[model samples]
Target: MLPAVAVAAVAAVAVAVAVAVPALRHRLVRSALRRAGGRYRRRLEALSSDVRLNQERRLRRLLRAGTGTGTGTAGGWEEFQQRHPLGQPCREEAPEDAVPPLWLWALLPGCWDCDPRLQGSLLYLDALGTAFPRALSRRGTALLHWTPGCPRAPAGWPLPTLYCTPAAAGTVPSRAAALRLQLLFALRQRELHVLEAGLAAELHDALVALRTEWPQLARELALGRLSPQPGLPEEVQRQLQALLAPDAARAAELRAECARGFEGILQRLWPQLEVVVVRMVHGSERLYCNSLLQAECQGLPFYCPFYQAAGALLGVNLWPAEPEPRFLLCPDWAFCEFLPCLANKEPQTVLLDELWEGREYRLVVTAQPGEYRCRTGEVLKVTGFHKQCPVVEPVRRESQTLSVRGEDIPEEQFCQSLCRTLRTWPGARLIDYACVESSLLGDFSGPCAPHYEVFMELQGLRDLSEGQRYKLDQCLQEDFPIYKSFRFKGSIGPLRLHLVRPGTFTRLREALGSPRPMPRVLHQEQLLQLVQGSIIS
Candidate 1:
């Protein structure tokens, strides 16, 4: 009889424990809901409008009613989910009734919650005032980023789109700004191509016309010879000065001209679209090398100060100790799905389908108005994941390498070595530089069959000494293991460094029929082209 009693007691205790556990869980969940509900109420009270306050109150009620542990609450939540599913229509023309339920709204970008209509499009504008008409034309939904100084959006911009702009009339809160600028560049690649081509042609034609007028200068440019000029004409000197010196003012003027030209095109293309301007504390948005929309300028990857700033604003560390220079985020991952590798083991077989989110790969992208699997030649590392999207950092270019036999020195490694060495010389600024294979020039032949020549445009030359140069060489050897081995074996000659004028790179770009910044790794063929175009002193 005692044994029977013990068994019954144990069974009763087990049943009690099961009931108690569920009760405890219910109590905790309710406690959490109450706290959340209170916080939402406090936030709601801060709203300046009765309508918004009422909406918040209603939203809170829905949360409280739907999120309880009761059977009725679970049923209510399920019904709500059915009404506002995650896979609901994602189009610009989504109907008014298609607004996301209050529960899902909090998790989305803040702009989406501002208006029921914003369910449709996302538009992001920047200081350049250029909109992606090609991309915009296709999507009804967009997130528009606007700077403080950008012009107001023209009427008839599709409703239900979120505009994340500075604190101004009709601007979304500052907290809702897009995290990456690559989304803008990638989405608007079509427009970027048009602009890049137009600018390059304009600049190229202008140079050709200048050559026609100044025949001697023209002849010098054509021959790529920089002979000591006994006396140059004032106009020719001015032109050469513009090309060779770092003229910030002149750069600004050219940038402004390009901006104006782009704006004019936009006005003609879509008069209803207002250009969004992105302003930061430094200054209003101005054109830079990244504006060219290529993956990198020379060996350096495409970088935007705005991207860094946005990351900082969000309290996220988006950059690494060393620059990766990759595309961090794209809204539509499909756009990057078809990018081909810039370099393959076999030159003839260069097409590659995707860059995995967590590895280093070459970048090639397809843009509309007809660009498909265009090899950008940019090397990028997948830094992290932005949700399911990959955050890429541009490291270097596939073409930006110096190879002598099996010794390969990549542009990123060289740049890093240069940076490390430059740090030893405080206050020294690197204006520009170019690297080319020596065999292309035929200046150093025989033993130096495949060598590299680095032309540096350095400012503040006082600190440069023989020891520093040796250290620079040592840094390169250390950075590139293969280079060190080749140097030790005497298979490759010592890398030669020449200090060029301040604007050598700019002049090179202009002479090369490219308005965009010149690549750091100028191949032998490009060097040949420069020599043919006339060497700017």
Candidate 2:
């Protein structure tokens, strides 16, 4: 072993290399990119004016229309229940495909008064056919899902186009990655076209730079030459092997190196823009990934697993759909049997046995659409009735609940406690949260009981003093009766709270590289990985 002084010197040098080198590299790259990016940004801004105007106009129209409309009992679940209120042992089953009249379906968002379910709703014509004034592409299949009454295209507006490279959907993550990348590419191209031709010169130049780098960068990414990074999209993955060389001893190290390299390339290539990112959740449903601005800066409301539920309920009263054409609950949720939701304040699980006029159960639905007793896994608190129609606010997912030592703590309650705790401290906000069963419980020799380690990201606050932490603990206990009982009875240990830096959730999600939504609760191994990856303890 080296002398203590020598060891200390070596440690200092290693730390310097790890931190200083990255900082230096970032500074250099930023300077280089800024020189070229300035012109590009200016040009893009000029081109985007028309698109912005168009978007503004459309938004105004939507807001006006939404505000003008009222939610009626004509299309709500309660109304359906009034028609067929019970699920009996021998009663005739409602048809799974039971949809409201065509006129009603036309009222849906993006429906634009046109029936989307009708045969030949989309018209696919050959480019060489009489409909085409000029050929747009060399060769490819096309598909269109047409809706009427969408903001009418300007006179000179062109038809939309989507180009996809077919790939096998072997797993959810793989499928999601492919779809996301393709969609992202399509969006960039669409936005590029939306800008004014004269103002797009600088942007066009930037694209030229992109065009030059993309091919080589993509190739390097595919071959693991750029970086041995993980979580790269399928477009780049298709060119290379999924994993590094088959050496178990160094696999983790090699993969980490690759992931770093891929990240570096992405930072260099991806344009910085103020935009919201969304990913598909469970088929066609879209969910937003909390933006960096929302999480770290403004603390604007964004959907987390818990928030998804909490917000829905708040929406019922605060953003009532009735008397406001804009607000809707399950606007597209038709032809389904609602089943298996829980209460807002309790853990009692309810089955979709029947519908009463004013009672709200969890929104479980069974319909000819696909499955039976399929719990949408959502909780709903019913508001009032529009006629016999049920107006419900979404609560949270049943899967978000955590159970240990007979104590069940729902994610919604967890969020409520977190928000309540933060509210007491002005300027603080809760960004994201997760919990894991404590692995250290085994270290205690006498009457050891497992507990939870709660991890959270807070904006505009740091250094959670003991008193503040205690307040948080008390709030949690107050919110969860079972948890409080478990804690008092010595069935569980004191809750451990960990404050992580802002954007920690974003990093975790990116590291996970899955198209699936980030989970609100993590198991032991997952939690360990998250802690390891986090920016701060």
Candidate 3:
């Protein structure tokens, strides 16, 4: 019985050992597997991040090279494709048929003003056509598929077909409404493509939210009524308000979603496109040439020849010698006094006046038929003057007097004033001048002329080069002049200026002399310091 009990105990011990050993081995294997999986995931994430970073850098370079005076052609396309290689199928596709080809995509939408609906629709379409290529190019085409609506499909459009719901179709009331629907649809398509392409799940959700909000805003815009305003036309306000209601909660929600989505998109897209967001400053000031003298007094404001000529043609109301004068003095008193004296059956004289010690004096002036008095100051009493000024060759005056405030002058004058104040400084050069208008926003209303704002592009002591050009651009950005009532708006390209050479500059200085006075040297010194600080870095 003792031997049998001992055997049972040994058997029990052996069974216990078997169970313990297997359990230990299993735990070890499980731990090793978990560690390996964790390392693998980390490695994958790092690789993805690096890949995205590289792609972004390449895209940024491409965009920078393409903008502003670069050849935006097939070569640009080739370079882009080479940098961002498509997969095997895309590589096999011909240039004409391939979506990535620059020729296939329209960079800017066509001008279509007559139909508001069509215009809105086309604008969205153009944006998609332009942006999708870049997105897919970066993310790869496997994530995207194109589809067209039934109407488009019937017309043999190459994109993937997406059906517009009957309810959605009915919701669109006007041609403009239909256009907006199309735009939203295109945006939705792009969003899905981005998601499918393995973008973050959060990005997809944000985009979905954004698309849903667009339609609600559009509906509100369509329903809103117009109000009276100066800058905003009634029709425009009505349409815009309905589309983007200021108070609507849905609109705000949509805006937030869009902002989030766009940021994500930009983060991904910016690097690939090589896009640089250039900061632009706008101004509001009118540009005008000083027209005070001619011949002996050429370009001088306070002198004769020009002034006398102006007076002979148009009756002056006040003479220069008058004490407390009320009117300009002129020889053509008959024309100033309303007598018909010109051969063209028109009056050639007008009156100019100044008020001194509460008394008004009249100065007679004669001028060509087209010339009109632009001076504003004191009231003048004309003994006799005529109203009719016919368009004929009566007498041509080379220059006329211009009244400017003590503060206002050409950009050159400001620079010169500063140089004069700092007599020790080297002379400055007028490198460039800009009559910048107050907005950078493009106007679809056509080519409107610049307004009151003007900026003088002056070069310091630095030599001219591409680097210098860049520095100048930077300096302008930093030390930009501030206008209390006017702000810088937009840039008009290919700036043209009647540049004055060194000789011409000297001539102007000699002509103006002590009368006009040189610009303050201190002002120039300050400007130099400001420009140096701005551009040097």
Candidate 4:
């Protein structure tokens, strides 16, 4: 009743002020709608946990017998897993098909939307068809065109071009196109339900591009700490300004909530630019890995389990209630929580049911159509669990972990150190980065000592001083105790950091195909040569 009375009072004030300030009336109404929608969505999320697993089961049934016949909801998953005890691991050798297992079906259920009931409202960085691995992919969007029950794309969201064009093949977007699309998506949040994009690296590029293209708006939203960037639609410019009020309290609040770095910049432009990063394992494109939500942004490639989108199903919200569970895996989609029978001979596998928090596991999937079992080279660590669904963090790719001299620093720790170093560097919006173990270097490249070679593509801070270069080495020491020990013992040499030419990664991505992502950990000499050639003085 108190809340209702307060809302009523606010409404009364808006009406009373409307007569004197007609222009501001629409603004107040629009703000009210966004707030009200937020409240409604939160209410839905609160109720989602109760029915999430049910919805997932419903989805799995629709995945077509891609997992094979004889599998039903009743203890069938256990039986199926026993029969296919082990499957082949993901390799560089390409498969005949790269589509999601669901592609076998004529039309993927439109429920991948926040809810099947809410039609034509989803807007992603790439069309679902365009998303590599194509989890829900094209058929999902095509349904919106054919079925009346399917939700239609909302006004001003650009579904046809954004969804169907040559641009649909995502992974790499040209700077100019990326900036325009990103700015458009940032403003569209006033109405849409969810806005999905690729990994953290790609999202950083978008945000950096956002600031580069619209300095004034970025400055005001970032509370002037970050330098200015330019160009935007007038209405969008007004909306972005509205996000940052002139009042001291609001400004202070913004400053306090946002400090420095991409994380801070993200907070400053949030709600309006709520971008979620989807991290799909590179080699195995058909399997959905996980996603990083706006709240859990760590400035790295990490995410909550893919099926946990229960908020969209049960609550229609981006966040979920406590004990956050994953929607049940399809009976057709078998998972392995078992340990590998061999040692370093095989990758580490996490025991899902008996998951020990902080321990890493190789995420395995049999979700692809006609595939027996494929051990995803991706590493996911158990963070927490909701009911039976495990909440996981994609730690790193198994092959990406630097193992020279047995220091074996995981990618996440390396990323954490890199991010920390970035915060201290001047004009840092780390666009794309790759790590190379000295082991990849040929005998002629110095003594071929064990160390790390890091290549970075940054938007600002043209060059680094000796001290700035040293910070990365210091940071890596902090992240990996063994690495520090190895350095101290002289077993490992110092880490080398390089600033690469702008568009180096872009050109590399183009060479790799628009749908393909650049490898984060460069193991091959060929890939290193391309990066080496692009390094700036």
The best candidate by lDDT is: 4
Q: Write down the TM-score of every candidate.
A: 0.40, 0.43, 0.18, 0.52
Residue 20, candidate 3: alpha-carbon lDDT = 75
Best by TM-score: 4
lDDT of each: 0.38, 0.38, 0.27, 0.46
**What TM-score should be assigned to candidate 4?**
0.52
User: Can you tell me which runs of candidate 3 are displaced by over 4 Å?
Assistant: 1-303, 306-328, 333-354, 357-482, 485-537
Per-residue lDDT of model 2, residues 256-374, tens digit only? 43345432222222222111111111111211122222222122121111112211111112221122111112222222244433345533333222345345455433332113233
- Candidate 3: worst-modelled 10 consecutive residues by lDDT: 277-286
lDDT (10s digit) by residue, model 1, range 1-537:
569989999999999999888656645543433343344323322331233233233333434444553333234322433543322111211111222333434324342234321211121211011223322222222232322222233211232222221113112122111111112222222222111111222222222222233333323333433233332234433443333323334333333433344323322322333222211211111122222223112232221212221111101112212232223332211123223244455222211222355566654333221222344554556666544445554555556576866676776667778768878977776655677776676643455535666667676773356676677778888888878887888777777666665545555654443122345667548554553343232
Per-residue lDDT, model 4, residue 244, is 38
TM-score preference between candidates 3 and 4, better one = 4
| lDDT by residue (tens digit), candidate 3, 1-537 | 569989999999999999877656644533433343344323323433333333233333335444543433244333544543321211111111122212222312232112212222222223232334332222111121111121211000122121221113212223223333333332322222222211111112223333455545434434342233233334434444444323344334444545554433322322232111100000101011111011111221120101122222222211212112121222221122222222356333222211122223322221222222222211233333222211111121101111121113334333333234224324544432323222321362146433222233343543334443333333333333432112234332222112222222222222221112122111223332332233321
Better of 1 and 3 by lDDT: 1
Give the CA lDDT, 0 to 100, for residue 31 in model 2.
40
What tens digits encode model 4's per-residue C-alpha lDDT throughout 1-537? 569989999999988886646435434533333343344334334333443344335334533456456554454444445656667675542321121121212122322322232211121221221222222222111101100111222211222222221122121223334334444334322322233443333444444454444434334434522222232234434444444333344344334444443443443534332223333332222112222233234332222223311112111112222223222222212433435423477644443455565666655654434554466665555665555445554445566677788777766666667879989977787666888987777773588458888999886778888999999999888877888898898888888889998878755653443333456788767778889999994
- Relative to the true structure, candidate 2 reaches a TM of 0.43
lDDT value, residue 191 of candidate 3: 23
